[model samples]
Target: MAVLVPYAAARPKTRLSDFLDSPERVSFSRAMLADVVDAVVDSGGNPTVLATEPVELDADATVEVDDRPLSTAVNDRLAAAADDGDDSTAVVMSDLALATPRVLSRFFDADGDLVVAPGRGGGTNALVVRHPEFRVDYHGTSYLDHLRVARDIGASVREFDSMRLSTDIDEPEDLVEVLLHTDGRARDWLLDAGFTVDVRKGRVGVRRER
Candidate 1:
């Protein structure tokens, strides 16, 4: 099966800027992408990065550039793959730092024409499209939109739910999730950068020891 990883090479992961500097955000984004690619490779899928610009990744992946909006680029690629008679295509987000080969294998092995793994706040973290007629929308509340679209197109749909697949590192709050859930490079980078979870006022949040 073909796995496509869409990455924003330019100005990536802006939400975490409050905690991470620009350079650190870039480095952390790349580290998360590497972890996702590693899971894809370990799952025995043909992994390719659909990058917005030319950026290097250390993991085993081939880079393809499409500077268009994410939904457009991914939809166009899926359509072309269907035209090429490919059976299915998987689009795995680049920021799933806690993702593992087991989670990815379960995602790819889901029994349906359209399988979706929803992110924490109404985003699509991963998807597998087995039907040529199915497409995607990555806008706000996209997980619900995808479910509606799948049903409208008469395609069988399944939803996969797991912390490993659902947890994408986007916000500052997500740093704690990574520290608690993953031992990957993203977590290591956070620790090396002096980030740790601290409890204050009956709530837990990430903090930097400086």
Candidate 2:
């Protein structure tokens, strides 16, 4: 199975803009992408980066630039894999900063026509499609939307649950997860930028050290 990682090279992760400036966000996004690619490779899978634009990154993967909407670009690859008589294709989000080889191994080893690892806030973080007719819709509660799509297409769906896969670094608060849990490039980048996890009033948040 080939893994496709969708990366938004141009102005990625706008939700973190309040915490990270434009250039910082870009650099952080690349770091997260590298972590994700490394995890895939370590899990014995080849990853292809479906980037929106040309991106310079130090990772062992093939880069394919497709500026189309996320859903369209991903579905095209799914369709192509189906046409090529491939048994399955996997899609992993680029912002899975905490994902490791062990987490992805379980997701990849799961048996189903449509295996999904849902992200926080009703988004899909990763998925493997064995059924050729299955396509993805990324807009509006895509986790539920994917389940519905699988049901409608008579595809067997299995949900793989893991904290690492569920966490995709997008919002400011998400940085805390990387600080607390990740031991990869993403965490190193945040620490280098003076970002650290702060605990206050029994709540965990991220704060930058001046």
Candidate 3:
């Protein structure tokens, strides 16, 4: 099976703009992608980065540049691969900093026509497509759309759940999870940049200590 890591190179992590400037967002997003790529490589899968533009990644992976929205790019690639007789392809998110090789292995070893790792707030974080009829939709509540599509097409579906795959760092609340559970490059970057978890007024959150 081939692993494809899709990334938005031009403008990544826009939701974190309030916390990180444009350059900082790009740097942090790249760091997270590196961690994900390392985990995919460790899991014994060949990884190809699918990017919106030509962006250099410091990892042992190939790049496929496509100047299209994530959903369109990924769908086109998957369809083309299926046409080329590639039986299985896994589309993994680039922000899974806490992902481990074991978790990824489990995902690839799952027994089904389709394996899905659903993210918080109705997102599909990672997906393994073994059936030719299964395509991807990444719009709002995409997990539900994928499930229905798989069932409609008579594909056996399996949902794989792990903290590593599910914890995609998209929002500020996500930072708390990374700081508490992960020690990857993203976590190290946050720490080096003076970010800390703060507990006050019966609430838990992140704060810049510096």
Best by TM-score: 2
In candidate 1, which residue ranges exceed 4 Å CA deviation?
Answer: none
lDDT per residue (tens digit) for residues 89-156 in model 1: 99999999989898899889999999999999999999999989788899699999999989998989
Residues forming the 10-long window of minimal summed lDDT in candidate 3: 201-210
After superposition, the stretches of candidate 2 with alpha carbons farther than 4 Å from their true spots are none
TM-score of predicted structure 1: 0.97
Residues forming the 10-long window of minimal summed lDDT in candidate 1: 197-206
Measured against the true structure, the TM-scores of the candidates, in listed sequence, are 0.97, 0.98, 0.96
Ranking by lDDT: 2, 1, 3
lDDT-better candidate, 1 vs 2: 2
Whole-model lDDT, model 3: 0.89
| Predictions in order: lDDT | 0.91, 0.94, 0.89
Residue 80 in model 2: lDDT = 95
* Candidate 2, pairs of clashing residues: none
Question: What lDDT would candidate 2 get against the real structure?
Answer: 0.94
